[model samples]
Target: MALDKSIGVGMIFIASFVFLYYSIWVFILPFINESSFIQQFFLPRDYAIKLPLLLLLLSGLFVGIFVGKVLIKNQQKQKSKKKSQ
Candidate 1:
């Protein structure tokens, strides 16, 4: 196979989970973890910013990898089709 099926699926799955986690931790939880009213209302805080950014980056990487694998598979398919023709 031009792309490893299990790896491609796994990468996408992992990326999706990372994206979910980032959304919850970075975007959602700060409102809930209110130290004070002002902190909650005005301060847009990225709690654990670096780690989430890293996770976001990793998620992007895995997505890109999955897309590249798909493209490789499509290209191989076209090549096989041309040879058969």
Candidate 2:
């Protein structure tokens, strides 16, 4: 529908903006003079790596926990079904 299409376009635009911002902050910012005004706009360069690494680690942990929970529930269901049979 029109609403869904508009939402998708908005999301895409936001994502593109974030990607461009982060890319500039990480890749291009480092090469620029540290004393320049642009440097003040971004966090310290170390965070460019640390933040993403932390996010990746946390997301992986969450995914592992989710898969474990689903597997445990599936196993429990199978055992109960077998017992009933």
Candidate 3:
């Protein structure tokens, strides 16, 4: 239904926004308390930025996929109903 599609879009939007904010925090927050060398090249520093960015990107991607799937399913069902009618 249209309502379902709208809800899906809204949820995806909100989720993507939250992920973006989280990514910013995760990516940048560590620079506040650590040494420059450790912050730049160490395992923790590297993972801090990379992991959060990857998660953020993947979350957005999956949300988009979920929205697309929902829309497609709704359209197919409606098309089938129309055909039957």
For each candidate in turn, the TM-score is 0.47, 0.81, 0.50
- After superposition, the stretches of candidate 1 with alpha carbons farther than 4 Å from their true spots are 1-47
Top-TM-score structure, candidate number:
2
For every candidate, C-alpha RMSD to the true structure in Å:
9.6, 2.0, 9.1
The reply for model 3, stretches above 4 Å from the true place, is: 1-42
Q: Of the pair 1 and 3, which is ahead by lDDT?
A: 3
RMSD of 3: 9.1
Residue-level lDDT of model 1, residues 1-85, one tens digit each, is 4479988998999999977765765667666747655444333454466666887999999999999999999999999999999
Q: Could you arrange the candidates by lDDT from highest to lowest?
A: 2, 3, 1
lDDT of 3 by residue, 1-85 (tens): 6999999999999999877756655666565666555344335546656887898999999999999999999999999999999
Ranking by TM-score: 2, 3, 1
Residue range with the least summed lDDT across 10 consecutive positions in model 3: 36-45
- Model 1 pairs whose backbones collide: none
lDDT of 2 by residue, 13-70 (tens): 9999989989999889979999999988899878888999999999999999999999
| lDDT of every predicted structure (CA atoms) | 0.75, 0.94, 0.77
Give the Å error, residue 59, model 1: 0.2
- Model 2, CA-based lDDT: 0.94
